[model samples]
Target: MSRGAEARQGLTLIGPPLFYALIMLAAPLAMVVTFSFWTQDYLDIDTTLTLDNYREAFSQPIYRVLLLRSIVISLVVTVTTVILAFPMAYFLSFKVKRRKTLWLFLITIPFWTSYLLRVFLWKVILGYNGVLNSALQGVGIIDEPLTFILYNANAVVITLAHAWAPFAILPIFVAMEKIDRSLLEAAEDLGDGPVRRFFRVTLPLAMPGVMAATIIVLIPTVGDFITPKLVGGTDGLMIANMIQVQIGRANNAPLGATLAIISMVVVSLIAVGIYLAGRKFGGRVE
Candidate 1:
């Protein structure tokens, strides 16, 4: 193809999606930004430019606390999910010599159900009169039901980790599968132990998938409100829950917009930091 024709074809391929993003994503984000600088009256929106929303968001202790808690929870969930998934992914990639597709299908069985239903199932499993407590009682393991398992930050982390497991596994598995087996054999021949081989060879090669999985889980988990809402009681409430309150019953859209923007900024910074750190570590490995 000629240069001009190629250019036109490229534009043709990208133009529709770019325009859609402009309309659906950029435009809405712009509106939220604009709204954040405005104020809301009793039943009307005061479009006058002001910084009160941001000032309140930063000055308020609750917002800061919730934002920090959300970050912590997200980090915990990401680490837990990645740790748990690595073994499973490793098994599937290296050890599972037969019926790999069946195991993978089973791994995705949870996804066939609604996300809300999964949350509710966890709630049922963790609640005071839930399955776990009942099972414990039935087995005579405890005289009383365990109240510490549900409706808290721990629950949030566990739920999110479970929910995001597949996301973490798939990328890591892909990365591990793509690794040349000869490198591992060569490392073994060189008198490297299994642990050393993994650290110096397998782990480094799998970093790309691990990084992708981390980013995928971290971003969404930080902003998740549903799991927190269903399983997270007062102490477990996250920034997203507060934002939802502001936009919902609180009738303070401006404040909600401000909080949302702040969250986006914080998440963006974290994602960038993680990417840079991973890149540096990967460079060291190389």
Candidate 2:
């Protein structure tokens, strides 16, 4: 086939899905961005492009606090999940010699149930007079149920970390799987101890997976509203919760769109920074 014909054929194959994606994803995003610049005039939208929404998003103390809290909660959840997941991923990749598929299947069992059900399960475990507290009382560990575990930021973090654990594990496991085993043997041959070998050879090569896991966990956790609503009481509420309130209860779509845009921008910048840092570190390792 001629190059022109090949190009046309490729376009024909790609065009339908590309158009569908633009309509489904790009159109809604563009509409939100456009709305963010306009104003809500009581019963009707003011259509006039203005920075009032953006200015309010920045200036308002409540918005600032919620945004900052969301970022902090997301960071904590990302770190907690990745740190816990790394050991499991490493074990799955290096220690398990058989039934690796079975172990992975077990790991994904949580996904079989509804996300809402999982959140509610955690609530039962963490609630006052619930499983954890009841077990503790039965064992004489504490005289009373603990109130701090649920209906707060701590509950939010624990739930989010659990929810995102699989995401963290899968990426890191894939990265570890791709690592050349000979490199570890070579490092050992060069008089390197196991710890030293892991740091110098295994860890560096696996950085791509770690970076992927971090981004995967970090981005969605920032915008999580349902988990917070179910378990995170007032102290645990995130910017997304506020966005929900604005759009639904307050009936202020423009302000809600502004908050959503600001969130996307901030998350995008953080994700980019992480990606660049990972690339730089990988380059140095090479």
Candidate 3:
């Protein structure tokens, strides 16, 4: 094709996506920025502007702690999911050839159900007299129920990790599967063992996928209110949960809007940092 033809084709393809992104994302985000500056009284927002919402957020130690804790929990979940997904992705991509589709399908099967239902199911399983306790008792693993399991940090982590597992696995698996088998055979022929080849070749090639998965899982984990409210109790509450309380119970719309904006900024910064870091690391790989 001529250069002019190619240019026209590219524009035609990109125009729709640009329009969609602006309408779907940019417009709503612009509204949030507008709302953040205005004060809401009851259902109506006043036209006046104020910075008290931000000042209040900074003044409250609990809000600051919640923000910090959300970041920490999201980071932990991102790291843990990557570690756990790596081996599974490797198995699907390099080792298991016969049932690859079946395995991938199963990994993503839980997502076919409702997201809220999954959160509620975790609550049921982790409750004091829930399935875990019953199973443990039946098997004589523990004589009594563990109340902490249902409403704590551990429960949130466990449940969110499970919820986010497929997101990490699929991307990593796709990256690993893209690697040519001849590359592995070439490494083996050079007397490189499995571990050496992985570090030198497989891991480097898969870094982009790992980075993609990390960003995906971490963003949702940070903004998740359902997991925190259902599983994480008073001690395990995240920033999102606090924002919910501010808007719902405290009747503090400005504070909630401010917190949401800050949370968005923090998560965006983290994601950008990860993306840049991933690009740098991927460049170093091969």
The lDDT per prediction is: 0.92, 0.95, 0.87
What TM-score against the true fold does each predicted structure earn?
Answer: 0.95, 0.97, 0.90
Superior by TM-score: candidate 1 or candidate 2: 2
Per lDDT, the best of the predicted structures is 2
TM-score of 1: 0.95
The candidate with the higher TM-score, 2 or 3, is 2
Q: TM-score of predicted model 3?
A: 0.90
Instruction: List model 1 lDDT by residue over 251-282, tens digit each.
Output: 99999999999999998899888888877776
Q: How do all the candidates rank in terms of lDDT, highest first?
A: 2, 1, 3
**RMSD to native, candidate 3:** 2.5
Q: Please give the range of 10 consecutive residues that has the lowest summed lDDT in model 2.
A: 277-286
lDDT of 2 by residue, 31-58 (tens): 9999999888667999988999999999
RMSD of each: 1.7, 1.5, 2.5
For model 2, state the Cα shift of residue 122 in Å. Answer: 0.6
- The digit string of per-residue lDDT tens for model 3 on 1-286 reads 9999999999999999999999999998887776677787777778688887788888989989999999998898889888998899988887796978888888988979998999999888988889999999999989899777878888888888889999999989888877888988999999999899988878888988898899889999999998888889987799999888878987767778889999999999999898888877775422
Which portions of model 1 miss their true places by more than 4 Å? 284-286
Q: How accurate is candidate 2 locally (lDDT)?
A: 0.95
